[model samples]
Target: MWRAGLPGGLRAVFEGSPLSSGGSPRLLEGKVALVTAGTDGIGLGVAEALGVAGAQVFLSSRRAHNVQRAVETLRGRGLQVSGVTCHVGRAEDREKMVQAALDTFGAIDILVSNAAVNPHFGPILEADESTWDKVFRVNVTAAAMLVRLVVPHMEKRGGGAIVLMSSIAGYQPMRGLGPYGVSKAALLGLVGALSPELRRSRVRVNGVAPGLVRSRFSAALWEDEAVREQALKELGADRLGAPAEVAQAVLFLVSPLASFVAGQTLVVAGGAWSRL
Candidate 1:
């Protein structure tokens, strides 16, 4: 059973923190990784973990200012990193992101497709075509295209790892986030379908399904008293999850530690009942 009740002060605590805090591992010492929607929240946390794990990271966000700030924040930690402005919904931006990574690091060893959007949070039946398009465009289509762009580079390097950021809502739908939930569910199938084909090129494809994590992206879920209470009751969660916890799972997926693990979705939902 997964335990909860992590103390509030221990929110951002992880294996290696503050860069100068020392004890950084060399698990991905010579790797090059690209993370989308990496300016903050889970994406930022995942980038930090990869950087601490010794992988040179190239991250992106839709806003140029966000991209710049994220790069500065991580660089302050003494981690090797760079950034680019990429609205994953745009194909041109996606191509630019891939090109930026290659231009900076020469080759890509890992790709973490962490970009997603939820334009509407109401009932699935009420959702319009544009809303659904936006959700899938960022959450699913963009991820697949990014993977397609990075696979050749990974193939050139012999083998690589890819992680798709999914959500527990995908397995068990969230009350009002129907469109978003459906998009995340698509990611699970995306990984399963791509893993075998990519494996032939020595590329491992996997997915991470995080529960209610404490971040701006999920502020609606964790910040509201009623919502928080309901989440605690339904998920049996003692406290909201920290992004670093999810990042640890991403680090493992992209690192050599999970070399044999592929086509699977690792649930980091604090024991929440998440089964397909």
Candidate 2:
């Protein structure tokens, strides 16, 4: 006979359960994500974070070899991941990227527009027309276009999140980073313009502005000992920010926890440039 008030039956099953995993279930389970320029640096870091959180992550780069290598590396870590080659500045390529995500995961819940190029670094007035156009096309127009392409697909899934990668230079123009900085500033405006429309459709639009991040793309800024020391002096952060640090802030903005967040730019610059 069972003792009075003894935990038994379903209670016994619960008490003796091996079915429960020790860690909490992933927050992003069953979601799908697309990260542009995800073959390296900050983009790759964001992709890895989303994958670890249980999202089926789709990444893209301009080079086929990089795409293959990134896909292999992420898969090796047992993440649900895939990749394709895409030049974000091209319309056809952007369409192909969106289509690839749909084809691979059925729906996309998160879109990280992390691709940008700084072709020229000099006085803003000294920049040639071609340089200006290239900077705007890749750093601003491409990000906007990618978001436009993903909106319908995200809508199909009832709602989704979009993160645009801006830069600290957007808030404070750095010398010799003229065109690139202007383009990043434009992204901030883009986020503001898109958020109201997106929220009504249950989608969220956000931006991340990182300062002095240590990435190959920004090596010219910090690779020199003298330049690095100067940047540290100007910026409050003693050390340059890591790609992964930026990725974590981005992950939070895209996650369900940020469901109520929209039309906001979370500066991940280690208190370098605080407006308020």
Using lDDT, give the best candidate's number: 1
- Kindly give the stretch of ten consecutive residues in candidate 2 with the minimal lDDT sum: 1-10
Leading candidate by TM-score: 1
Instruction: Note the clash tally of each candidate.
Output: 0, 0
Backbone clash tally for model 1? 0
Against the hidden reference, what TM-scores do the models get?
Answer: 0.93, 0.90
Segments in model 2 whose C-alpha atoms lie over 4 Å from true places: 1-25, 274-276
lDDT per residue, candidate 1, 220-270, as tens digits?
887989988897677766667878778888988888889999999999988
Query: What TM-score number comes out for model 2?
Result: 0.90
Model 2 agreement with the true structure over 148-235: per-residue lDDT tens digits: 8888888988999999999888888777898998899999999999999889889999999999888788899899989987876776
